[model samples]
Target: MAPVALIACFPCRHSKRRCDKSLPTCQLCIRKGVDCCYPKRRAQKYIVLPESNGVTKDTVPTGNDSSINRAGGSNRSSEWDQQSPLEVSYATPSVIQSFGTATAIQFIAPSIFREAFLEIPRINIAIPSEVAAHTGEFDQIRDISATFFSQVVIWTPVIFRKNFFNIALNPLSPRRTEGILLSLCMKLYCTPAAQDHRDGRTALYKATKQFYCEVEAAGIMSVCILQSAILIAIYEIGHAIYPAAYLTVGACARYGIALGLDKLLVDLTGENNAGRPWMEVEEMRRVWWGILILDRFLNLTNPLRGLTTKDPEYDDYLPVDDWTFLNATAKPQDNLKISAAFNLKMGVFTRLAQATYLVNQALKFVSSLPPPSDSDTVDIGKDTAQLRRTIWALISVTKTEFDAHDLATCCQTAISYCAILLLQDCHWRRVRISSTEDAYKHMFAESECVLQNLALLAICLRKDAEEGKSLGEEFPVFLMQIVYQGALTTIEMGQGSPNEEIQERVAQYKWLLQHLQSRWRVAGIYLSILQSKEAIMASIA
Candidate 1:
């Protein structure tokens, strides 16, 4: 069985700060001068139930199935209304212990290398032949590739499909290795949790991860390898794989820098840009952007941590628009129509990137604010006003119900509103600490407006859900962060509310995540957070 770890404290839970949940007091609470209150709680045995029909097999609860446990076999779904998020299956500590902890190097490389490093004269390496690099059955791989492109690609798009199918599918060709690595990643991402980790890591995850380590050992490096790392990181994150998720993404940032991915778009405007293959460059650019996006999104739970990559500069070029993804004549930054204010025209991936940028900005802005006691005399209204306007500019311009069928766009929309929720939270907290009535009223009015937009968008999405599938059956699995943030936002700040409107939103966002658990167990982790929040609110009342 996956070993359980301690949960976050109350302040950490509310603010997304990292917590070790130590007894007496936590380090974060000590540093911040905040109350370190662990819930006065006890454990109870949870029964696992089978998922209903029409549910994706992967959604069945796995112990850290990837990012979080799934809804499958949980008699707990209905219990959520009466339960706390504390019950989310947690196995990340053991994952870190197994992977690269100080006490043991339990995964990939041999522990002997670590123990006898100075004693060994030299480390010998083996090179595998082309046949040894072989992945899986051709037809099965083909189907997996198609499924990935059809579903997950709309958000991540790590590889370009048109070029991939044309050049890289051959097991006989040199490009076949990259295709195989990418295929391996998609298979890991797509495989259901039904047969996944019950007491230990699943067979498929172990095999794919081993193959990835082998490729690295064989000196394989490319955009596809990075994409594979990203898939693993995403999987780890969804399953709350913790330090592994953190470390995997940090490696991506470093590897991206090592590969000079930061220069991909910058090189586009140079005189030497003429001969470069636009498709290959696009793929490279997307991979780099993927690293950047993941780097920021991963830090959402710990906003004060230094980002692996620097925040995006105002003119940092965005990706080639997703719709014109195959356009041969398209030049990088040609699609950018910059103005003081502008419409969201780039594409869904770009939209996701933009929203992530807002999240980063919110983190920075909030981090810069002084504690309420100190900031009481500071005139920071201008700074707050400018930041609020910047958030709304994106939210106001986006097509609220644009292409309801495009799950990527839906994810993008949800994230943009999440930024508002994040910002309003900062403001709301400030007002409460200062006991400023004017500030509270202002925040309430503005937050209400922004939340109404989010609610409407959720309604449009709910309409599209199939009759029997989960509410979020069609959403991309990577959207768990945004959905979780939205769910947390719907609860009214300060006094507890019986507001029907607030309850509707709270239920709606929860429904989106509850159903999405079918494909990605990450949803279950977020639901646990909601449960924890409910417990806190209940205690206060």
Candidate 2:
């Protein structure tokens, strides 16, 4: 008889396309939501044997039950039958190379896995010879460092400008960590200019890799290296490669824990003071804050993933004001005055950090609950009440300390507002699942809070637009996210209410979203959503 050839399943066969011949089912059938059926198989009796090439070939099992059982042929057949095309493609190679003791496939399996799962194609970026040749150029290093400090340092003040410049421009010796930081700094600084200068951004990216290799070669751990890791994470975030950014921050956190940076030092004497400079201790704290900010934002944006610092049980003090940090050797009284001068700025950063921390804590608490039951309803209620109180207190305090006109202050205010929406969304979901309430009064209140904050955001953006100030340069991506949420909230508030205030707020939000259309893609998306009167009216009704 002719050899029985493998055939496609019904779905693939009917569709007139190639099939992977997956037993029982195939990817196309699974994706198309259809039943997969194959033709009946013929019974055969054959043998299996292991070869000298570390390969195994199988034939149909013979009629001896004991022999079939001992060979475990049934289980092998079942596993093969269940295997997907991807799995089969991974395991069986068309050709294998044998070295003295090792058998190698022509292709690496992990690359195939990445291609299949992540769908991120690999692209090789050629490093220019001049970047390597100009590694020691003082002017080039200074220019790049200056660009970073001038543009990016205002938002993130972890690096001391003078000290960074001195280290990078040193002729006799240059620190590997500092070089790495400078490369990352250049990458971040060049990002905004990328639209105009793609080649420059590419060069900076290549230079960053070169510097990162140098840091790896040195294999030294210090505060500066930690700073380099943070900057690299920030660079990755700006570039919107979130998974890479997440991994970078995870590495930073682990390295930090190993170095005792996460531990709150109760004793400042003895080993702590023996040789460690005060500057180093303070810098470590600042770096910790940086890590916390990055971690919180990561979790906020991608809540489904594992968070690096879930609760941040450590008691590291918040970073001091910029002037106090810069004047490390200043007198206590002088530092106090500077702190007072920047107290509002300091409070804005600190309060936002605390709000983010509390949000994360609340999420962790909610996520830890057992699936809803009659007995758990009361406990959920109490927890929900406590969270509401905490959120309210944060909003009240932010209001009292509000800087209505400052861009950073307004940006954070928008976050505080958006958090209300997220909190209520969580609350309503659990309440409905638990069958606890038919109506939630808090939902209306939370929606109003969102509208108010969005109005405030609109005012802030309007002010900036009036002054011709561009938020495109230093605006955090999350601010655009806040704007997006605000647009939705405005629609919710204005839907059925014929109240003029509601209409006015909705119009203001629409204008703000439209104005930001040229800034970020998010703005355009929100603008389009708000522009749809039909959708808004339908949703409202």
Candidate 3:
């Protein structure tokens, strides 16, 4: 037979392209976006092939028979199922090496500590050469102030998170930070300048404004840091100078308004309806208002000096009535009324307490001075007597409005303050004491008072909880827990002491913790009941 030629499909042959031969649209037609044309064809009948050899009709294989044999043997086929040379085991050598390198890098470059001490940029204020050239005393003050600012940066975030989450964040750390900052600020104010008053005021204004701005921007974790910074600025300005600028009522009002603290309070408590029942919000507002009032009183310009003032600008921003908003929003119930009245009364007492504290601080500062050799030891006995009288008077004022419950609560706060003072005094005395016995006695006495106050506070808290009163209700449970912890601390401090007073103090602290724990457990149950009721209502809705 002559050699046969294969013909291409009509579309491919016409377009001068290769045909795929298996589809309605050939590869060329599909690629070009043209319709594929196919010629009509009739179905052909299959014909059987003749035997290749005549060994036997059954042994001779035809084309169709070969195809059938190949199909039947497919299950046993090896050629199609063979693995390629490129195929490798699950654990490849290259993959193992790659993973090992990654693991080694991780071990070598641990990021934990590196990230922790990362430095952040901070604002730098230039001090004049003359100002910086002050005594070593000024350097010490600067170091303390700087340390406080750094701490504020560190702690601001922590406090914000705690407050925002309504968690039991410790106030002591922030309080300590604030104290240190305040001390530093006092030192700054004391640095004598040609224009001491104006310069001191300007420095204070700048520092306080910066502190406020930093705090707002820093978020919850930086709360302690910011608080410390603020305290530092306040303290430096208030105490550094002989006549403190911050001590004046006008200065206080100006500082408060400038900081926009009133608005900040609303911003903080307004979200999530934190101050629910309206009364709670009102109470908080009153607390902040009182704080502002105290701040103003402590400033250099006394707004309350008289109705008339030299500067009209000073009185422009002052709130018309400090307690009006609070009074108007208070709940009508007798209990809330009593609570509101007590809070106001306590607010006044707190101001007196602060004054007492300030006076004591001033006395201590004065006493630290070396007595003139010819001046007969510079007797401050009269001054000390007056301070004692003032303390008693303040205590009396606090007692006047106190019920059995409120009195106990007030005692708790007052005692805590006393404990802090005593602790500080003990630390100072440790360096100067001649008799260890006397020092131990004083320490034990202070520790005992702290425990007693905590016990009294816990008892009052329990009573209030039982009566469905709101005092301390919004405060974190950790606060109560810490009160118990404080008692434990006292007990621990008194252990292994030879003095009888110390032993008694230890015993009292243990008893206080035990009683407090029992009361707290009951309070927890009440909280659980309230939570369950809320859950039930939610489910029904």
Candidate 4:
């Protein structure tokens, strides 16, 4: 065999070991757990060139020659010997074309970018100094009052509603119990005073007129009835005091010849009245009667001057001298004189009377409930017991001295108690429902009603506070804190649900927070002003 030059070999073949000749797989493949192979290369066959008509004899290179020149001017090996390092250059046609096109175009002056960078100064513009100052003041005032009114209205309802709802749902709420007691107190004292006070009666009359007008505009006939009733009570009080102030008394008297008490009594009790079915109704009637009695007592001639110092117990039933023009007149047990005296004193008696009536009515209703035959009876029984206690507490307040300041306090206290009672009623309604779904529905409804009443109470309390009357010293602050805290807590807890109901509740809470902040701010401002005044006075002194 002819000796052949070794080209590329596998690792095993290079070591003089056996080659597997497995095409791609070799001996090394077995050891490395892989496949390896060599490719077949085709060999070129050499052909002797024939001398042709145009061929030259010296064209081909001879073997073992250093330099053999050919007709083509170079040998194949010489060409290989003349080879140098490879040179490479790159050109991007797209980029080059883009640059060429850009260069061909005319450059525009004041390009968008250039204009943006070289704008003229705005020095020509000037704002008036006064306008600027006014702008700042307007902004400050806007900021201060921006959320004030909105927060006031929104938060007032939210807090009141939440507190009312929670208390109403809570069968054992202390607040509810307290409310009942407070209502009783106001009925006994505040009702009578409010009935007699000319200012208070006038305010009520004006408020009622406004309420009626609004209700009529809205076409809410049900609400109109309530307003009318309130008006009737107001008119009755007015006529009992100053007959001159009772121009409408004649109109009211068309239903009845005297003060319309008989008509009111008939309206309150029908043939089927069968005693007070609802304690609230009875209490309301009692309040009405109480104010009337108190008003008549005040109208007695010289009652304030000690001319008619009859037995205090029989004051409600007695007729004193008719000193309408400050002239002494001997009147013999005149019913008109008795009625007039009660009217004069009605200012100090109205509120207390109303509160008393409401409490007694509530208590009477509770007492009228059938005895509980089962576990459900326990709840009803407890509510009735609590309600009675509340009524008694309210009634106890009536026995105290009736003064303006005391009367206002009593009203505030009574309103608070009424709020609690409403809450209790809501809670009981929830419990009475048979199913969870029904319970939730009833709960929400009752909650809304309780909330509205609570809001009204808050408004009343606010009005009382504004009048520079005592909210029982620490009581107002305590009540406010309790109500605010309770409302916030309920909102936080109730906001877990992602439903529409919960969303609305959260919105209400946000409104309440903003309202509270505004109120606190106002209160703070008031305190600051007061302090500043005191400091100035001290400095002057």
Q: Which candidate achieves the best lDDT against the true structure?
A: 1
Q: What is candidate 1's local distance difference test score?
A: 0.56
Q: Candidate 2's residue-wise lDDT over 1-541, tens digit each?
A: 3332377654464457777777657767778676655544534222232234657532322221110011112332332223211122111221111110111111234332212211111111122344434443556666656666565233345665545554455432223234435545554444542444422234565566566555434333455667777876765665544467789889888866645566522222112223344554555655666777677666654455677763654242455565666656522232122112222445344555555655666556655656665555534445556665666666665566545545333434555555666555555555552211232343646555655656776787787778988755555555666666665544544444435765676677677656644433345555666667527555545
Higher lDDT: candidate 2 or 3?
Answer: 2
lDDT of 3 at 489: 42
lDDT of 3 by residue, 1-541 (tens): 3332234444454445677654555666677665554533322111111123323211111111101011121222122122121111132333233323322322354232122111111111222222223212333544544443333121111122222112111211212222222333433333322244433344543454454343333221122233333344333332233243233333334333333334423253332233233433333333334344234223212222331112212111222122333244323221122112323443432333243333334334443545335444433333343444444444455655655455433432443334233333434333333343444444433344445555555566565656777453113222333343454344334332425654454344344333333323323332344335434534543
Report the CA-based lDDT of candidate 4 relative to the real structure. Answer: 0.31
lDDT of 4 by residue, 74-124 (tens): 223322222211111122433233322222221232232121111111000
Q: Which stretches of candidate 3 lie over 4 Å from their true place?
A: 1-257, 260-325, 329-383, 403-405, 411-420, 423-501, 510-541
Better of 1 and 2 by lDDT: 1
Query: Candidate 2 — what's its lDDT?
Result: 0.50
RMSD (Å) per prediction: 22.2, 21.7, 31.9, 41.5
- The parts of candidate 2 lying over 4 Å away from their true place are 1-147, 150-155, 186-190, 193-203, 206-210, 264-273, 302-304, 314-316, 330-349, 370-402, 407-415, 432-440, 444-447, 488-541
CA lDDT of each prediction against the hidden true structure: 0.56, 0.50, 0.34, 0.31
On residues 233-298, what C-alpha lDDT tens digit does candidate 1 reach at each position? 777766666687889899988877655577764555322223346666676777777888778777
Instruction: Assess the local accuracy of residue 85 in candidate 4 as a C-alpha lDDT between 0 and 100.
Output: 15
In angstroms, give how far residue 31 of model 2 lies from its true place: 75
Lowest lDDT sum, 10 consecutive residues, model 4, at 116-125
